[model samples]
Target: MEKKNNRYSLLLVGLAVLLVVGLVFTVGRSKKPTLNVYNWSEYLPAEIITAFEKEFGVKVNYDTYSSNEEMLAKLSTGATGYDIVVPSDYAVSIMIHQDLALPLDKEALPNLANIDPRFLDLYFDPGNVYSVPYLWGTLGIAYNKTKVEEPVTSWEILWDPKYKGRIVVVDDMREIIGMALQTLGKSRNSTDPAELMAAKAKLATLVPAIKAFDSDNPKGHLLSGEAWLGVLWSGDAALAGMENPDITYVLPEEGGGLWMENLVIPKGSRNPELAHEFINFILRPEVSAKLAEAFPHGNPNQAAHALIDPEILNNPASYPPAEALEKAEWLIDVGEATVLYDQIWTEIKGGR
Candidate 1:
């Protein structure tokens, strides 16, 4: 009987050990890894997020900002734990200057070779050290065919007296100011205080002609017949055209603001390895093709072009002719000159 008791005690101890091990295994399996992504609104597709989560067995915390300045302001307030951020070309320059991002590990990004060489080595990110091109777009004019009834070749049309109270411009200071500067035959990236003031004055003149300053869904106003003319991003105009055939987009004769958005791994990313994995996944031709199909923006992934439908690839709203591209210019970081521009903008907008 004593020997039987001893065997029973040994079995009980073994059972307790197995129970502990099983509990630990269950807890570990329940705690999945996660990634944080901060990007533009509606830029990334929902299916991509779900696919990545299923394939990697990780959760994604995706957040979006309407503009680069808004993203910068949030980061400036000490926001942290962001694994990835998408910034426009000029914003990339600002982030690089502030040392807010990490150098990419090219070894982990084998699909980086799929990006078109034309989109690489841009002025804001030379050598492509800190950024990778995501998409390219132009700031142009979108107008209703029945309302305008004139050749939309110049930025001057936005200031036409007849378009008074019928025009919509983006709330983005850079895009609106750039249009004014270009219309005056100045550089799209003009940093001179006098030029900026001049542009501001010209924009002030256009205030009477403007109906609303919209950033999100300016196309909505166009579709509703509330706005006949608008300064819009190429992708927004293309999206508008898809809904209504009469919505036409045109590049200004002076030049339009050409821009590119890039993906960067912000500093303090807890999951750097996962961040690299996500970028590599995005660079895959099939994934890029999916993004192109969802958004009408110009896809910088050359390898994905063949995978994309020819109709989308040939759409002039998304991909204009080479000559029109030549007339376009990029906005750049103006260093200390941003203060002057901001001051002018504040004065024009009646900002307190």
Candidate 2:
């Protein structure tokens, strides 16, 4: 009886040791951190994410949204666990004002020096204390050469009755209104109620002509011949031109809005250090060049310029002339005026 009891006790002890060992191993394996990133649709190359994961052993949970408002709304709820987000210059300003973004730790991002000085210390996050410039481009017209005989030089072409049902505009409130404001020789960031009303009136004329309002893939409309002319980001226009030689991107004579998308850590980041590591990794010259090659936007990293493909570097659409940039205006945060914008945009879309 004593021998049998000893065997039973020994077996129980062995099982307990095995269970503790299993728990320890499981906990150790689960300790690997995850970095959640929220960015624009089709913004980052897949390989970059893979490379970062392999190098840091940190899993990347990347999610994409089509607009700044969508990203802002998600983060504002404070329910999401996004560690990083990309927002446009004006949106960055809004985030800063709302305390939705966290200040960047420059010490962790030593590669920030690769960014061009011209893109730094701008109206949004002056001194770049809270954000890093990722990609930049202009809002302009992209037209199919075979579909339209007229030279597309101005925003007025989008409102021409002849092109009715063949034009596509981005489904963004600020961009569409900004274009109208530009056409009227006003600031894209104009807050005057009278100016906004005038812009809204001008946009009303385009209602009948717009075939579809798309922000995700306006290039698809242009590629399929469903849209002869489109208001598009320069990078999207560049991609369309590459896919179909008939597509051509042109800056309107009246000038257009210039925007810079930025990388920022939100206020509730779960892995702030990891976020900084990822930002530094992306700012590397080689990595930034790869991004420029994949997205074909205006490369803000001066060091990446030498490594960029000549075809992309020389593309006038991707890198507009100095004069065009000089005339361009960055969209600034409009604060409470945003409510007015929202009302007008809703009215326009509702055909009110």
User: What is every candidate's alpha-carbon RMSD to the true fold?
Assistant: 4.0, 3.7
TM-score of each: 0.90, 0.89
lDDT of 1 at 206: 90
TM-score attained by model 2: 0.89
As for candidate 2, its clashing pairs are none
Candidate 2 regions off by >4 Å?
Answer: 1-30
Backbone clashes in candidate 2 total 0
The parts of candidate 1 lying over 4 Å away from their true place are 1-31
- After aligning candidate 1 to the native by TM-score, how far in Å is the CA of 100 from where it should be? 0.6
Taken over the whole model, the C-alpha lDDT of each candidate is 0.90, 0.91
lDDT by residue (77-99, candidate 1, tens digit) is 67589999999999998998888
